[model samples]
Structure formats: C-alpha cells, structure tokens
Target: MKNQTTTTSVTTGQMFRFVFGQVLNRRWLLGLNVLALTVISLLEFVIPQYEQYIIDHVIPRRDLGLLTEVVLGLLGTAIALGVLNYLSTYYMGIMSQGAITNLRTELYQYTLRLDTHFFESSKTGDLMVRLTSDISNLQSLISANMLSMIGSIVTFIFVWIYIFIINWQMAVAVTLTFPLMFLIYRVFRTRIHNAFRAARASQAQMSNQMQNTLTQIDLIKSYTNEDLEENRFGAYAQTNKQDMINATQNQAIFSPLIDFVNYLGVAIILALGAYFVIRRQLTVGQLVAYLSYVAMLQGPIRAFTQILNQLQQSLVSYGRVMDILALKPAITNAPNPVNFPAIKQGVTLDHVSFTYPDSDVSENGPVLPAVTDITFTIPFGKTTALVGHSGSGKTTLTRLIDRLYDIDSGTIGFDSVPIKDIRLSSLRKNIAIVSQDVYIIDGSIQDNILYGRENATDDEVWQVAQMADIADFIHSLPDGLATQVGERGVKLSGGQKQRLSIARALLKNAQIVILDEATASLDNESEKAIQHALENLMKARTSLVIAHRLSTIHSADQIIVMDDGHLVEQGTHESLLKANGAYAKLYNAQFS
Candidate 1:
C-alpha cells in the first residue's frame, strides 16, 4: 500500500523457489516428465551419430542390409521418444495446474487474513491482476520449456563430450565463444531488466485505472463525465503502449546479440573443420555431424534469453504478490485471549485515541487524529445514542469497539476483560452493525438474511423480516424469500435496502449492536417503521446508535454528544438540552 517501488531483481533461481517447491508436490509425475525428456535428449543425440555412420559407412560401402537395420533402429527410437513426449506434455499440464491452483488459493486465503487497512489503501483491480493475470504468467514461465531446457542441457553436455573426443581443436574453438557470449549478456541484461520493470509498472497502472473507472461507471454517467474518464483511461493505455514498445525493443535486441555470438562459434568451427578434413584428420561426415551439434546447441542458447525474459516478467508479478504477503496485520487476536461465552457486564472505552493510516500524509496535512482521548461505557441492555456533527468521530468510535482498527492509546474492555484479550472471531460474533452504507451481496433476500445467522431457520428469518418491516415486501414478490437482491441490492430502493440490513442485524441477535445512522436515508414514514423495529431489536441488548435526526433518539436511555473527537456532553436528551451544551446545540439545530 505504501508508494515505494517494489524490490524486483531476484535471480531466476530465487524467483523459481516457490514454483519449484510447488512442483515437488507432484514430484513423481514431474520426475516422469524429466525422465521422458532425458530419453528424448539421448535419442536425439543418437540420431546425429546414426546419420554420420550411415553417410560414412553404410552409403559408401553400399550395404543395403546394414542400412535397413540402421534405419529401422532410428525409427524405433523415434517412436519410443514420441510416446514419451506425449506423456511428458500431458502430465506437465497436470503438474502446472495443480501448482498454480494451490498458489492462487493460498494467495486468496492470505489476502483474507489481512486487516481492514490493507484493503483501504490497496486497489481491488490491481489485486485482481495479481491473482488472475499475474498468476497465469507463472504457469508458462515454469511449464513452457523447462523440460526442453533440461533436455538441451543433457544433450549439450553429451554432444560436447562426443565432439571433443572426435576433434578437440574444433570443440575448443567453439568453447572460446561462451565466455564472450556471457560477457555480452551481462552488458545487455540490466537494460532488459529495466525495460520489463517499466512495462510491468505501466500494466499495473493501466489495470488500476480500468478497474476504478468500471467500478464508478454510474458516477461517471450521473455526472456526465464519461469523456473525462475516457481521456484518463487513454492516457494509461498510451503509457502502457510506450512501456511495451520499450520492452519489446530490448527483448528483440537480446536474441540477435546471442545469435551473433553463436554464429561466431559456428564460423570458427567451419574454418578449422576444413583444415582438419584437408589434413586427413577428419572426414566430411564428422564435420557435418559437428555442424549438426552446433545447430542443436542453439536450442539452449536461445532458450536462456527466452527463459530469462519470461522469468523477469513473472517476477514482476511475483514482486506485487510478495508485497501483499509481506504485510502483518496490525490488528489480530492475542496469543492468549479470553474464551468467554458472553459479556457479563458491558462494553467500556477508556481514553482511546486513533488516527487512520494514510500513504500520503503530507497531502492530507496530518489528519488531526479522528478520535482522541475519548472514553465512554454502554451499560448492558441500554441504548446509548451518539449525537454529533459529521466527522466528530461517532462512526470511528463504533469501529474501534468492533476492533476493526486498533486504538493508538488506551483500552477498551468487555466485562472487565480487555477486548484485545478476546479472540477476533469471538469479538466480532458478539457484535452486529447496521452501517449507513448497506452492503447486500448478490443473492436471494432469504440468502442475504441467512448471512446474519448461518443456520437460522426459515421461520426465524420470516420473524426478523417482520420486525424490520420487510416481510410484506418479501412475501409479495413472486418468489417470496427467494427473490434476488441483485448486486448490492440494486433492485431495492434506499429505504428497502435499509430495512433489509436491519432485518439481518435482528436475525444475528448479537449482544452488542451498533446502529450508526442506520435510518439516516429513510423518509419520516419509513423512519417511523424502522424506529419501531429498532425498539424490538434493541430490547435487553446494549445498543449504540448515531442518529441523523435528533428526534429519533430522544427516548434513548443516554445521549453522548461529541465534537472534534472529544466527548462534550453525556445525559438524557432532555437533560442535555437543559444543559445548553454541544448536544443541546445539535438538537436545537435540527429541531428548533
């Protein structure tokens, strides 16, 4: 989430550690693939020797019977190797899929473990790229030619040994070029790396822009700023285009640079080979075979750069994923936490202070700490309403109680036990919230309500729906409880959505309930309907409500008024108005 550049220059071996570890999970199958590749390499190596022998012995001697036998042997090896190739490729797919599936699943589960702050600063679209596109890149990187590279390595070593035995001078001539090739690669490597890094950055930026634009499509259309959005997206696309061009340029040059080195080696082999043949030290077939070796050598030579480029691209994705994995949640359950079944007394906050984390603090000019040295207690079975102007830390206080964010200082405890000493699941299960921003998943209305209590009965669901005044709406639909809510309840009006949320909370039946402006969007009639439901839902439960309309909470057991993150007054609404303080001012501003 921080704006610092990610570290991305790890060696290919280092980049492949995770992949190799994953491959080992299907080690036997992968081992078979390796074995098959080894056979293919050995058979291919034998074919060149057979070609040389047929030219030097069988053809010159005109032994049709020997030629027939030799040709048949070659055919048999090819057939066997072909079968092996099929098995290797088929099972390699199985291996790659298995590994990538596990990796993606682990990444998703790990992302879920991260606290609220991580999602707050991170982009959903960028994370999607890491999970989907980036994860996809890793497969080709490992499976594309790993087996071929292995085969090439085996063949290269064996071929070199054979060629050296036949004529070490020609072999030596070819060997000299390797160090020079490596040196050339060293020179171009950094430029290639930098180009890939730039391209990856551009890709991430483009993905982020596209994701944000699509998510806010409604806002763009509502404000008639579609052209503005289009221009912004085009800029990202153009930047990506330039990055791709730069990357392709570097990649395009590297292969030729390597090819040039390989050509130099071949040239030296050719010139020396002629001298050997003239001196009666070598035959033409041997020279041809040596040339064949040189040609075969190109497989690995080209593979090296090809593999390196794909790896660099994959590591760029890896670096993004590692960045998320590196974060340790700021909020987590204590190693030893209370296993209390329920809260015995009440919830209490003592001198708690909190400031939201920001990547660009300077731009915000120090957020001035949303909640500072504020303390309060909500007695069990009592409704405590928070009254304050917007941005006065009312919602922030409730968030702290839920332990969504840890406080900068001081303690909040439940039943004399610090909330931090309670398991996170235990803490959350006991608290239910109906926030102003209603989040309804795409599912049937009953399916949404069942989210409140995973195993709530059909009758219980209907009962809570009645309390929230949404049962009639559900029953009137053709499908009743099965009627779809669409994405975020897009089919429902604002008041309908609010009632559905209330129904979910009532069904949850948590001991500690926080209703932060739950009815803020409802009209007077809808508000009255929800108010009656709230009374039923709040019965004998500790409730913390933040009211947009002052009149809604006049009957609340206690009213706490806040200003600029400080608790300015606390008492009954009538008493606060009599005191002529912050609460009175807020109430009079709305009702006077």
Candidate 2:
C-alpha cells in the first residue's frame, strides 16, 4: 500500500516517539519499572563503595566489629538489588505485552478498513509478515533490549561521575575510547540497517512464497509440479539464508570491535591507576574502587554496542509496520453521511466510467478503462438482465452500485439521491450479491448461512435454505446444518457452493439483489429450481442478473446488452428479438 518512492526518511527521535507512545500507555506499570531500575542502579553504585570501605577502613584498622558491619551492609544491598531487579523485569514484561497487544489490535482493525484495491494488489504473505513477525520484533525490543538500554544509560552516568571525582586524570585517559566507539557506531549504523532491511524483505518473500505454494497444492499435484515448486521454495529459502548471514556479518564485525575498544580503555586505566597508587597520591583501596568503576563503565559501553544492533533491526521492523498504518483508504465515508433511503425510483447510472488503479499497460499502448460512459437504470420491483461476454464490465457495474469502488466520471443515484451522499454501511446493507466465485469460510453450514444475517433465527436460516433448494442436499449430510465446510468449502460441490451462496443472499433479504452468473455452476435441474426460487426472491425488489446463457434471462422484464464496456442495446427479450440487434444475436448464437 505504501509508495516507497514518496516516503520520507524518519529520524531516530521520531521512531522512538512513535514506538514509545504506544508503550507508555500503561503509566502505572512503567512508573513502577522506572522506580525499580533507579533503585537497582543506586544499589550497584553502593556495592563497590562497600568493597572500598572494607579494604581502606575496616581491614586497615583491624576492627572486627566494623568488618562485620561492612559485611552486613553488602548483604543488604545485594538482597535489595535482587528484589528490585525482579520487580523491574516483571513489570516491564506486562507493560511491553500490553502495549504490543493494543498496537496489534489497532493495526488489524485499520487494515480491515482499507479498500479492496489494496488487497487485490498486495500479497497476503507479505501482509501477514507485517502483522505478526514485524510486531514481534518491536515486542522483543520493548521487553528485553529497550529496558536494558535504559538501565545501561543510568549505570553509565553514575559510574562516569564517580570515577571523575576519585581521579579526573585517569578518568580522562579512560574516556578517550568513547569517541572512537561512537564514530564506529555512526559509520556502521546505516550499513547494518540496510542489511537488516534486506533480510526482512527476503523473509517476507519467503512467507509469501510458502503461502502461495501451500494454498495451491492441489494445482501443483494435478500438474505434478511438486519438484518445480520445491525448487522454487528452495530458492527463496536460500535467499533468506544468505540475507540473514549478511545481516549477522555486519553485527559480528561491529560488536567485537566495540569490545576491543572497551577492554583497551580498561587496560589503560588499570596501568594508570597502579601508577597513582605507587605515587602515594591514591590508596590501594581507591585504586581498586576506581578499577571497579571503570569495569562498571565498560558494561554499559559494551551493552550500547549490542543495543545499537537491536535498535537498527527494530527500526526496520517499525518502519515496515508504520508503512501499513500510513496508508489511507481511497474509499471512505463522506462527512456527515446520511443513511440510504428506502428505494422507490430504483437505481440509476448516468454516464458512468471507471478504470481500475492496478490495470496494466498492454503491448498496444496505455491501459483502457474497464467501463465507459454507461447510462442505465434498474427499475424498482423489476428484474433487469445484463448480457455480456467476459470482461465486458458487467461485474464492474454491479461493484460500483454497491460502492465497492467509486466511478471516475458521472453519477450513480438511488431514489434521486447521489450514491456517494449515502452512508456506505446503509447503502451496502440494501444490496446483496451472489457472484459466480463463491467463498465459503472454514465453518459449519449454519455458520456460513448465519454470515448473511448474524442475528437471523435458526428457523429463518432453514427456510431460506429450503427456498434455495439446498435443503435436500443438506438433509442428506449426517450433521445437516451443523456440517463443517472445509477451507473455502472444498468439501462442497460447485453447484452446492453456489446454492449455499444463494441461501446466504436470500437470508440477507436485501432490497436490491445482483446475481452474476449465480446459476452458472448448477446443472439443468438445479438451475430450474434456483430460477424459481430467485423469482420469488426478486418479487417486490429490484434485481440485476448477469448471465452468458441468454436463455436464462429471456423472461426478464428488461434486458441490456453490453460490448467492450459500452451499452449496445436495451429492450425486452421478445422486443430485442424483433429488432434483431446485439441482444438478439447473442440469444440466437446460444440457441443455434
């Protein structure tokens, strides 16, 4: 959905703000976590000071009482540190999980509101990766890396100030490595981010490939293309492997280089502190305490390098997640939208034209519109038939009336009010479509039927099923309405699925019904029964029927013939035959 070419670069501060905004919602839990971390940091600083007391004061005075007191102080600090650490870790887990849960729910709900065009153009696998794996990356940062980074920062500041107070000269010499380490991070930051981005892309590709291959396993086996698909999958796996290795390669080189710098600082401080002790300018205890402080400082520096690696990876995931959230649906409700009024004058399209956004250019030249300058009406309480070949835009016309897409030109009206002015929910609730391609969820027969009207009574569901002539087949099954239809209704026959779809529409009891080749999959006997049921369903309501079998719509009150996105003819079936125009030719061709 995102147009990468138009996307601007986001700074680190912006990314943090966006991510932390979601995380900081649980203020009480975060407050407790901060309190624990602060206390833990202060306790860490106190422990080394106790070590200095024993060496410089207690041991030198040979005072057993003071030694025991110092030991008891050390024990108390360690216990307090342990308890605070537990509380901090526990509280952070709750905070991070809560934040991620809310974020995921919001992302999914927003994604559902996006236009149909977005789904048509995007791969399911890639979207799944964004929703699941990408979000998990952010969770990992919050739960583990982010909290640790905060602690490291606190420790670094406390130890740095303490070391400087004890001996500024040694502290100054030790900190020379800081600038070099920072320079190394700056140099590798972009390189590491790019590598991780490549890895995430490759991971998405692999997920998409797996989803495609697995869902179409039937096609693969029928054509005996298993080996072909295997090889293809293997290629994606290999690419992902190479990408991960490349990402890790950047990290592996960067991490140890940071460690080398850190220890080098420690080495320099060790030598300098020993020199100060021999000069009598520093006590042995002070030198030991200073070395401990330097080690404490190195912990944060080393942690910072690891945190840098995670920060880069988390940014990549965050960017991917944000890209989806940034997209605004092309089709949205108008401001102050009113509910669609009850139909009286029927539906009208005046010089309507539309071209799909994802339409591709052909060898001839630019892409052509799917429909053009079409003006027609479906009279209220009458059956109107649309007769056309494939890609003649009959389906597109139905989609437009339902407001699944907006027309590029002209106006579509319902009872003299513009379709766009009506509330989308109210408009769609009045229309029911039973398309040729029926999609049944992995649910029970009752569940699928109930999808049409969520609050419909069980008796009402059965009545519609009986009217659609699917009751007989349903009765034959052991579980009847309770029978499970496997994924996409793979367990059902073609005609059965179509009938189930009709049963769904019948239960909807909408004011306007569009049957696009609804009976195309049915046998002659089933088609006749469905036609009779549809006649009853269409009475006192507007109906638009599309079928290639011209005989199917011969009894319609009005017929419209379309060719290559243009309306070519309109008349009753017998009248069209008398004129011997486009409608007549299509009808004759089928019978002859």
RMSD to true structure for each model, in Å: 2.1, 1.9
Give the per-residue lDDT of model 1 (tens digit) for 295-346: 7776677677666677677877777767766777888878888754476678
TM-score attained by model 2:
0.96
Checking candidate 2 for backbone clashes, the offending pairs are: none
lDDT of 2 by residue, 1-592 (tens): 4343222356667777876788778777777787778778788888889988889999889999999989998999999988888878888888888888998899999999998887877888888988998888888767755776677689889899988888999999988889999899999899888888888888888898899988898999999999998898899889989988887898999988998998898789879888888898898888888888888888877777787767777788888887888889878888988888888989999999999986778999988999999999999989999997888999999989998899999999999889889998989888989877898999999999888899999899999998888898999999999999999899998878877888888899899999888877777887877776777667788999998678788789899888999999998989999998888777778888
Off by over 4 Å in 1: 1-9, 359-367
Q: Which ten residues in a row have the lowest lDDT in candidate 1?
A: 1-10
Query: How far is 79's C-alpha from truth in model 2 (Å)?
Result: 1.5
Residue 299, model 2: Cα distance from true site in angstroms: 2.3
Clashing pairs in 1: none
Best by lDDT: 2
TM-score of each model, in listed order: 0.95, 0.96
Best by TM-score: 2
